[model samples]
Target: MQLAVNMLLKCSESNLIERIVWLDDQYCYVVNINEASFPYQLTLEEVIESLQNETKVIVEQDPFVISVEDHELTEAELSKREFAWAIIQSIYVIPAIFDSKLRAQLIKEASEDFGVTKKTVRQYLKRYWARGMTKNSLLPDYMNCGKTISQEKSFTKKPGRPTIYDSAIKRAPVTEEWKKIFRGALEKHYFIKSKPSLKYAYQQMLKESFSKKDFQSGVKVLDLDNAIPTFDQFYYWYRKWYKADYVVRKREGQREYLKNYRAIIGSATEDAKSIGVFAIDATIGDIYLVSTLDKNNVVGRPTIYLIVDIFSRAIVGVSVTLMNMSGESVRVALANCFDNKQAFCKRVLNMDIGEGDWPMHYIPHTILADRGSELISDSLTSLTENLNIKLSNIGPYRPELKGICESYFGILQQHLAPFLPGAVQKDFNKRGGKDYRKLAVLNIQQYTQILVRCIIYYNHRYLEGYPLSKAMIEQNVFPTPIEIFKWGLSRGNGRLIQLSSEQIRSNVLPTGDATVTAKGIRFAGLYYSSKQALKENWFSQARIKGSYKIKIQYDPQDVSVIYLRHDRRNYEVCHLVEYQSMYKNVTLEEVRLLQLNRNQQQADFEHVELNYQIQLAQEIEAIVQQAKAEDDSSLPKDIKAIRHNRKMEKELLINSKYEPNNEPPVFHITPIQKNKLSLFQAKQKEALDDDYQT
Candidate 1:
């Protein structure tokens, strides 16, 4: 190997040698780059012998010796390099410059000629030789010239430039205590929910903590003009503690930051290289819907859940219901993704479709969604883990992360919803606007059918400017979603997984707590029964021991059957009870809605029921008042005598009504006879019809 200049040689584990300058075939110059050492001559033969014996190894070239471009140099740097080069131009070529005595004399003379000190001239020569003897190495070290913030000296008074507008008002010093105050004020006033402007917050801080109340023009005013830590001082510390991005997130909220302020850098296709990646989201439909039971009863806007394949931009799943965007809706939508498309389209839309028209019934490898309760739930997490699918929840309020699914809602609203009756307008909340809710004419089922047809049209609609892959372009594939999907499968690019309905339900269904009641297994206000429950006598045990809670997994779309989970693998299928057969095909949302409507109707009759109860109480009070007004003075006061008189009166009244044979006997109570009964007399009279009933 050729021994080049600036090559680092490791003679041992600790010591390093840099070949600085070449002298001759017999002698070469080297220096210890790690430590300060004088340049010395070494024998080329010795270095060669060390290399051959594996004693010294060439590690790498020194980084500082790399050539610098002329354009990279500043004017001042270029001038300095030229000046230093001129001073050492003649003496560096001579061999005598290597001698200590000769080098010192030459450097002294050059320093005098250049009007620089000998020490400065010697430093320039050392830098040049150490940096592979390049002219660029003599440039000034301007990179390390400025003093950093840490290197700045502490100040007694206010730092930075003096104010131009107010010279008399001396700015306050920002002490350690003031910094603590600033932090507390910022967190309390600026970063709080009522998000105030920074300037306003500063003024409020001064008024609340720093200033005293004073009267000005007969009005109470806060004397903040002479307060310690001026706005400038407070603002300086604010910038030090919070960055612009953090300030926006803190004051405006994280949702606002995600919606507007955050950066949009990546595409949905960045990680979705094939059709196995799906994006799922839900939105409230713009059009209001009525109840399927009664079209006159306006239910509300329907929640529409959609799952889109990121690779082909095709919607694979859809669920429309008069429910909120919740876990139930998400589960229903996800279950729909695995349903046979041919049957689903015919059953729901009432329109038959060929297999090629809407062909998507595969479990996705990854499901991307927002941090909704639907996706971030424990049941969903367990389902994804069991199914070997990755559940990715994007940041909160970041709909842009799953743009394909979010944009589909807008497409539906723009294309289908606006033309429908009861569709909401943007200015509906404005003054004197017509109530869009009153115009609702379609029910949930009707609206869902219309939505399904629109989805079918969207799938077949040709994409004009889709970003097709190289293989797709070469294959001359049509830009429609179905065509793109077929093309991807043909090239073996988009691999998908197919699963049976039973398998999918076992892994993907959401679970809840169901009670084993004496009536039956009660879940979502419906009753269910199973042969296993009967064999195990669960209901009898529940009746004897009182009802208890059990874990169960059920599909929200259909309440006809539910799975009783014993473990991960074992699940007992339970059918709806015979008594609850009316609600056999009802959804969990529909059941809850029916319960809510019944509750409202009960509430409507509450006032009339309360009035009836009040009238009954008033009648009882009137009768009690009339009885108290009667002649009770003529009756006996003694307990024994009163009981005897009442029994005689009852018998007399009974005899007069039944026999009518003799005149009814009249009994009068005498005051002298109203004496208490003696114990012996009471015992004696107990045998002869002395039984008194109160």
Candidate 2:
């Protein structure tokens, strides 16, 4: 039958008069709340008034019902049975639970509900829970009845036959003599081993007195025939004393279920082993990295959204921003994935799941993830479905299903965040750890590149799995996340390729401080030096299109490195400094030095030669005048030597004869030599020369 409040009482207190104090129309009493005293002698009107006042809460009631055919125990009987159940539960111990704490919690709840102090609640608890409490008060004098009351009547059970027994070991008013004995047992048997309840020890000692011995003196024996417990019974006393300290009582069945179920929970996340199986998940956290530039920390300690390729275990796209993550963020991250294909073996499993403008090869075959509405949003799913992706779920609240990304997030928290520049998660964004490391400043794009670089580093450079057997160094393996993605990527479409010969190559400018330097363009915040590239303008005149050395910076905001510059156009490349130097066959400084080293005196010698020639021509004019004046001495010594040599040349020319193998010899030169020697002829020429000079 339902109680007046329409209820079956569960977890309520006991007692018949306390259980059903209301009379229904059938003249049967029942309870809706805490039962009042039966008060059967009161007049009906007085009872009605009393009940009215009781509803105001000076007194309240609990629910109770009576059954015409009953199988459950009576209130009193049920309480007794529950007490036994509690006692059994208390003694049954298990691992993984702190006993005392559980007990304390139950005690606290019960005490508050019953409007009792913790001590009272615990006393009730220990009445059945603490060991040796139930078997107390067997002997007539065991309960101190002889000293405090009539021993025979007070200590005896019905008909004077003893049913329970715990004998007093000694008799005194709160005596200290037995304290030493109890203390010794506590030190050796209880306190020395674990937390000892002084109350439990007292009860244990009293129980021992009833069961084993009462006094050390041979004359004294604890009579078991009419035994009963007294305050002196150590076992009962200890239970009463430390009643509040008992451990909690858990249902045996509940514990068994838990033990077996834990394994099932662990297995829930395991996935099928098949090719093209991939799990995609996003992780938002702070990343740590050595900046490409100063090797300092860069890329803010800001929140980064990383989409890890489950197949390759590679982080294909990272969008780290100062802002919160959104659908657009996911799209951007996916968009950035194509650029990092070589670095990551992970590809999103794309099926007939037709998606956005995404290249077909980049699509995933199966996207395994949770059903978080974010993943199922039309924007996301439409793309997945369009790309022919077969979607599987890890189930809600089960992150371990996509464990690679989860583990990746964990690794980020432990290994990377701490090493990052600035106050990592707290103030990393403001300080720009990644940006500071590479560019000495934060430009959202470049900083993110730094973070991506960190991932690449983790994959290729980090040591993972087991330590090496032969070498002192560990085996460096790709990050497992990247490995997973790569495995997926390798299994996917083979039709996708880089630029082909049939297609005209569109060159992309080096981004960031990515200007063509003697070094290659900056990417992911790192400036990669390339030998083939000319300084600053390599992209502009790129006759042959090729992937330029990309200076990488992990973009904390997103997966794609910003490649520093905002523009996509190519810039003309200047000659690399090496080429200029090699072509000139000299250093620029050497050329300048040689030009500056000329002597002024050597240069003046050319003027000296020209002046000498002019003076000689004038001297020849003066010689003609001198001959008219008959002054031969005016000419300088060297010139007179040169004239004498010339005069000798004319005489030789006039007198020389040709001799050959033939018989002919020249004989005509004799007349001129003869005329030169003749004094009369010399006198005639001198007269003629004087006339001409005049």
Identify the candidate with maximal lDDT.
Answer: 1
What is the per-residue lDDT of model 2 for residues 1-694, given as tens digits with 9 covering 90 to 100? 1122111222224332222222322332223233321112223344345445542112222111111101222334445445544443443332111246765676676666656677755444343222111211011112223333333233222232343654443233223444455555554555433545656655565555435544666443455564333443455434533323121112123333233321121122233432234455565454333322223333333445555544345554554544344454554455444343332222211112112112212333455656554554445544443233456655557887678767776675566445444323554447544433333333333444445556665555443662222311233324444443333333222111121110101111111224443344433222333334434456454434543433322222222223221221222222223423222211122222233333444686879989999999999999988787985553334453587668766666655544334344334546865765595567768877998999
Off by over 4 Å in 1: 1-273, 343-356, 371-382, 392-401, 473-476, 534-537, 614-694
Candidate 2: TM-score? 0.26
RMSD of each: 23.2, 37.6
Output the worst ten-in-a-row residue range by lDDT, candidate 1.
61-70
The lDDT values for all models are: 0.72, 0.39
Candidate 1: lDDT of 88?
A: 69
RMSD of 1: 23.2
Q: Per-residue CA lDDT of candidate 1, range 1-694, in tens? A: 4454444567865566664454444666676665534468888788878888878887643444322334445567778878887886745745677677898888888888889998878777777766545455576666447633444355788888876786534466787777788888899889977877888888777767676656555644555466367787888889867868688878888768767875443334445766668899888889887765556778788888999988888889898876677776777788889777787655444557787767777766678877676676545654554343677767766777788788899988888756799998877889999899999998776777787778888888998889988867887889998777666544333435454455555555676899999989999888889999999999999999999999888876557789987643356899988877776544567778878888999999999999999999999999999988984863335565587778887989887888667777666656554444355467556644544532
Q: Count the backbone clashes (under 3 Å) in each candidate.
A: 0, 118
